[model samples]
Target: MEGEINRSVHPIFTRDPEDFMQYLNKQVSVLKEDGKEVTGWVYTIDPVSESFVLLSFTDDKTQLDIVMGPSVRQVSVLDENSETYKKRIEAMFRPPEVEALSEEELEKRKNVLKSWLLKNRLPVQVAGNNGELLSISDALFIEPPYGVENCRSTNEIILGRIQGLIKNMPSDQEEWC
Candidate 1:
């Protein structure tokens, strides 16, 4: 269940990419079975270890601020010097030495996790007033298998603010944006 917008920026609670990757793979598997929509990928600071990751959203860039206690601002979104870009390119070329999980095994593991997530996860509504496929900013993906509570709070906040912004604007003004 989602709630109304909170315009203030929320503090980033955490930034554990490996944990996110596992959860994503699992969620994707189960969602695909039931034909649910989700965006999934492995995000890494070291592209050299991860492999075969096709780079999408190269044009994507946004400021990320982790404000749980202190303000650690991060420039999120993918770029040439961005972590995603670095890992993806290195992942593309990294050979047999640094593979984390076998592709087949990773897929299987994801299936199991997806099944579990489908059972325990809570629904957090995310919508874009501009009515776009990628308009979601913040959504509470119920704590995953390992109790990672704020897995996506940062993104959810950004998307939620955008939604709030769109809702208050005039129809014609929306198109001009």
Candidate 2:
């Protein structure tokens, strides 16, 4: 609702991804070509297809609606529900909790990963203020525990390769460390 649009206009189909970002977590009323109106909180918009996903919440259930780009006649902001709806959307997709590992066990896992990377002849280094990060490349770093999920990289190719390598790492490889 920050950049509220008043008039009935259809620019959503041609709107840039940046424009869609503003609608995220905001209550919106989308007018379709057939006169059907959809009102919900904006969850996501597909950059490629321009289709947007909306979430409608009730006391006991949440409903999801995806509106196609071409069918949308107009999209107007109704209100901002960023704080409440954002948490709900996140919770909907949040992964289950995992058991916490002790600091010593976490350190050992990190060391094992570093050793494995070394064995594979991949460049690796300790980075970050507290030396808690494993730097693999300019755009890539693996957080503590050194698991695939902890790997972060701007480059998708590099990220995928590193995560795949870690996933396929032989069990005996840990014994070598």
Would you list the C-alpha lDDT of every candidate in the order shown? 0.32, 0.81
Instruction: Return model 2's CA RMSD, one decimal.
Output: 10.0
Identify the leading candidate in terms of lDDT: 2
Q: Candidate 2 residues 51-123, lDDT tens each?
A: 8799999999999999998888899999975776776785576343212555577678878999888888899
User: What residue pairs are clashing in model 1?
Assistant: 1-123, 12-67, 47-87, 137-155, 137-156, 137-159, 138-156
Checking candidate 2 for backbone clashes, the offending pairs are none
How does model 1 fare in lDDT?
Answer: 0.32
Model 1 ranges with Cα > 4 A deviation: 1-98, 121-150, 155-177
Q: Looking at candidate 1, what is the lDDT of residue 122?
A: 27
